[model samples]
Target: MTLSAEYEKLEASINKSISEHNPRLDSFLFNGGTLLALAVTIAATVPWPDNVSWLPRVLAGLGAFLIGAERALNFGERWRYHRRLRDAYQSILDRFTLAVEASGVQRDELLAKITADLDQIRRSQGDIPNGTPLQG
Candidate 1:
């Protein structure tokens, strides 16, 4: 295929990867934050009856669990990682698109550079957790 077509394919793949990670990041932030807030709020406020004095302790425990879970899962870290990758890919894609539009012998050189840069970016994914449905 032509270099333009190849660039389009790669761009689409990278965009898909970015899009896929977005929802996961949002869900983790929204849900985790909400639950943590509720737990802390209940634990601090609302004096419980003697019959359920243990409720505040349980909520406190839940708050601690959420913090630990955030550390263990590294949701924010993963999200930032993917975002950095997206930016890297975007820079390469932008350069490729410009090279293609310019229509010169330099297009081939830019394609090779883009390929190398993309490979490096993909390799960097290993630094983060695996199990991504798509890799660019």
Candidate 2:
């Protein structure tokens, strides 16, 4: 396969990786926020009965659990990591695309530079959830 084709494949893979983390991050944020809101709303508006005085506490506990889970699972960190990786890869891809379009450019040298940049990005991905060992 040609280098351009390989780059296209890599771009698609990176896009998939970036998109896969979106729902997970959004779910965490939305659920956490909703739980906290519900807890606050219940505490403010609802009267606690003698038998069932644990509703607000339970809601607050659930919200705390979500926060702890986020700390343990690093959803936010993973989302940021993937975004950074996508940006780095996109920058390299853009440069490569431009090189391909331009005349009298050193395509081979640019490819080498892009490869090095990709390697650097892969190395710098840091500790995120599910191990983003990017395959180029």
Candidate 3:
């Protein structure tokens, strides 16, 4: 197969890996949230001295911090995974160049498409929508 063909196949493989990983990622986030809730509840119900009314507030703050950390880690993990996928894409593109050069295929349109696609991706990440802050 040509480099372009190989690159297309690699892209498909990256998509498949993401599909396969989604279920695991969902389960992980669900479990993490559940654990955070349970810890907060347990902290609230702790039997302490009569003057310990501030305990729940402290526990709640801790719970919020934990949740924030969990979300941050989740984002970082996803970012790393996507970086690896993009690296795979670049590798395929490199191989595609070599193959096309060997076959002397007209490459203008293909290069244009790749450049446009990457530009779209780069711009999309910067387009943030208004939303409530998840943290205080």
Top-scoring candidate (TM-score): 1
By lDDT, is 1 or 2 better? 1
Error of 3 at 101 (Å): 5.1
Q: For all the candidates, what are their Cα RMSDs to the real structure?
A: 3.9, 4.4, 9.6
lDDT value for candidate 3?
A: 0.57
What ordering of candidates by TM-score runs from best to worst? 1, 2, 3
lDDT per model vs. reference: 0.71, 0.66, 0.57
Q: lDDT tens digits, residues 63-128, model 2?
A: 667667666666665666666666776687688787676544577677678788877866675545
**Model 3 misplaced stretches (Cα beyond 4 Å):** 1-38, 51-53, 61-102, 128-136
User: What local lDDT score does residue 49 receive in model 1, on the 0 to 100 scale?
Assistant: 95
- lDDT: which candidate is best? 1
Model 2 segments more than 4 A misplaced: 1-47, 103-108, 124-126, 129-136
TM-score of each: 0.71, 0.62, 0.38
Candidate 1 structure quality by residue, lDDT tens digits, 1-136:
9766876787799777666545466457746765775768577567999999888787777777777766667666766776677678778768877877765668778777888987888777667653455555
Per-residue alpha-carbon lDDT of candidate 3 for residues 43-133, written as tens digits (9 for 90 to 100): 8778768798888878887777767765655643554445554564555456446545653344655555666755554444332222132
**Per-residue lDDT for 58 in model 2?**
76
Superior by lDDT: candidate 1 or candidate 3: 1
The segments of candidate 1 whose C-alpha lies over 4 angstroms from its true place after superposition are 23-27, 34-42, 130-136
